[model samples]
Target: MANENTDEGLKRVVGVSGLALSIVNGVIGSGIFVLPAIVGIAMGAFGVFGYIACSIILAAIMLCYAEIGSRVTTSGGSYAYVEAAFGNFFGFVINWLFTFGWGILGSAAVMNILADSLAILFPGFANPLIRGFLFFVLIGFMVLINILGTKQGIGLVKLITVIKLLPLLAIIIFGFSQVKTGNLHWEHAPSLKTFGDTALILFYAFAGFETSLGVSGEFKNPKRTVPLGICVGGIVVLIVYMLLQIVTQGVLGAEMATFKDAPLAAVAEKIVGPVGATILLITAAVSCFGSVSADVMATPRTLFAAANDGLFPKFLSKVHPKFATPYLAVLTYGTLIFIVSISGGFKQLAILASAAILLVYLAVILATIKLRMKKQDAGEKTFRIPGGLVFPFIGIAAIIWLLTSLSKWEILSTIIFIAIVCIIYLIMKKFQNKKPVETTLETIL
Candidate 1:
């Protein structure tokens, strides 16, 4: 693959506000609208603690990325950092793994939106064929927006982010007033297993905060805004997740588990009747679209970076002839989403996304350690990590704990990807070490 991309990728016009909203756009997807019930299934009323714990763990990772982001201003985000620290082969492997996760996630979003939209539009119809067609139409529509222009695409993200936050705000404002202390108390002592399991689920909600970090190359002040966008975005997410959970538990109680599919709307219905639920449904649809948009916008940049660097096919590096977007990479990702949406069940795709993301978290934390150690050895310092070495250790330990705590699919994918990456690295290195012995001897003589 040759490096044929001529356009300097996406133009750098999105300001701090756009980047921050893009972070919110990427992070606050359908996860918050629905995961409370799933979390409640693991630990009942104690699920709020799991949300907070996942936030804390990711906060540490985010700070590490902030420090790491301070150092590198490339478009690839985590992939670029890992490549600088560990070189290109590992970079390609992690990039591939991250793409798998992003694809599954994007597909999950597309399908979720399709299923929800179908229910809204044709309530009694449970036709798979109908839903599948709508999924392509909607997903393709969002991808086409990106193919048009980055500025236009991110503008859409900002709009969706603002619109989607309204229902959540309404939930917090209206639902908290109807609190019941009884629901906050657990029926039994919560098990550590339950806690870990619940945290893994909510971690999915927190997964996409790195959206801003991945766009560093497109930032006007790449070094300064990247850290601010990432840290501020993370803090905002942590606050929202906590409040959303608190009010949800207060409003819904034991039924949180019952309405696990669309818990926020269920909570809203309890707060303000049928109209509230409808509003929340509209919010859910909009929020999920923002997430899908964020995924479509961000993921291709990494793929474009990989392609530009020869880690992926060169054609993927080419900008769209008309739009000047990474149209090939975007389409490739859209195709992956279409396949995953139609072929695999939603639950399966969700678990695979979790596993794929855990691999990325593991890689980033490991890269942070490498960068931090090198800084220490050189007697150089940069952004202060929130708790210094302690934070990184906690972050690494947290990801490991979550990896073990996740479902069987999450566990297997994490292990398998790591093993395969190592094998690939070894084979490549072996080939590099092999030389033409006769030619070498003759040259030396």
Candidate 2:
């Protein structure tokens, strides 16, 4: 057993800049690379409205997170906040929901995008065997970087984030000149259903910001960092997404639907020729890699936190003496992602991943309301949202509205998945001793 009184081996090294960049890396991922075409197909020149709608929804959710995260100040992000407000059962449920239901599945889907983008650049990647090998190498590489230390993991995220954005910024800057004014006009507004469905899919682009909050335990000063980082990072993401949508839609216009898989690359090819297409493809690969690396760096902390609270296997909580990281948790997470990615079943479940994340966000919003009513941090100087409960309610309504777009099967499957997670939690509790074992720092080294 580890010593509980000692501090966890994790170092508080990440600051606001790192956290903000992490949020950017998480939110602007593979979805943006392809979503332009999907939204453009659905809404034409008005497709940019989808980005605006999603930003509003995400803004509400991020406000709730900023408030609750300031008070909770722990790892596991949504899992930790909900557990503190509700109980261990709900916490356990959320941990699995966010970790496996959303994080792993979503990253696996993005891994497919990465592989496909790479295959465009290198034809050999088109082979199933080669793609599987690529998944193993990429996932293993991320695990190793994270296990070595959080700094290295974050450093790579920062580098790739910058690398991926350059090509995107270039398109936004140069492509607008080539956009025909005729392509920027729409005769009529899209119907509510059409708008809702497209916005629901675009929401996937903004879904992973919470994953960055999973490393609160390692944040240098979380109270200030959480709110500032989330809000600032969120604003940056909104701007980038909106501009990209405008440029992509403006450049490709109705023809965006022709290149469903790589809309941004098509836009690039139009603006700067074939060389531009090559750069955008490489950017897509790097952007996906950055998102997965950020996940590998942060999401494992949710597993580590859960295990320490006796909701997961104890081994996952063990901190490496030399590296001061949850090595086992990182390895486990990477392995799951690799399995799901190589098997290529995640695409079928992609909508389920979106639905699952909505549930997680709904839970967190409710947790914020509960925490506020209970005066959980009355004495502590924690960040509070400007509107008492208005934002939380907005977040709730937006999530519910978005969830309405799910098919009956996806909704039922989400319910089944939640029930299965709850059952597993109960079984673990039944076998646990009167006092659950808590893992802490084994040694400081």
Best by lDDT: 2
| lDDT (C-alpha) at residue 42 in model 2 | 92
Distance from true position, residue 364, model 1, in Å?
1.1
Overall lDDT per candidate, in order of appearance: 0.74, 0.86
Report the lDDT of model 2 for residue 294.
95
| Global fold similarity of model 2 (TM-score) | 0.93
Q: What's model 1's TM-score?
A: 0.84
lDDT of 2 by residue, 88-179 (tens): 99988888889988888888988988988888779999999999999999999999999998878888888988888888888889888988
What value does the lDDT take at residue 375 in candidate 1? 39
Residue 166 in model 1: lDDT: 79
Q: For residues 342-441, could you state the per-residue lDDT of candidate 1 as single tens digits?
A: 7756555455566677677778878888877773435444465765688788888887876666667667766776687678667765765665675799
Candidate 1 has its poorest 10 consecutive residues by lDDT at: 1-10
Stretches of model 2 off by over 4 angstroms after superposition: 1-6, 348-351, 376-379, 434-445
Clashing pairs in 1: none
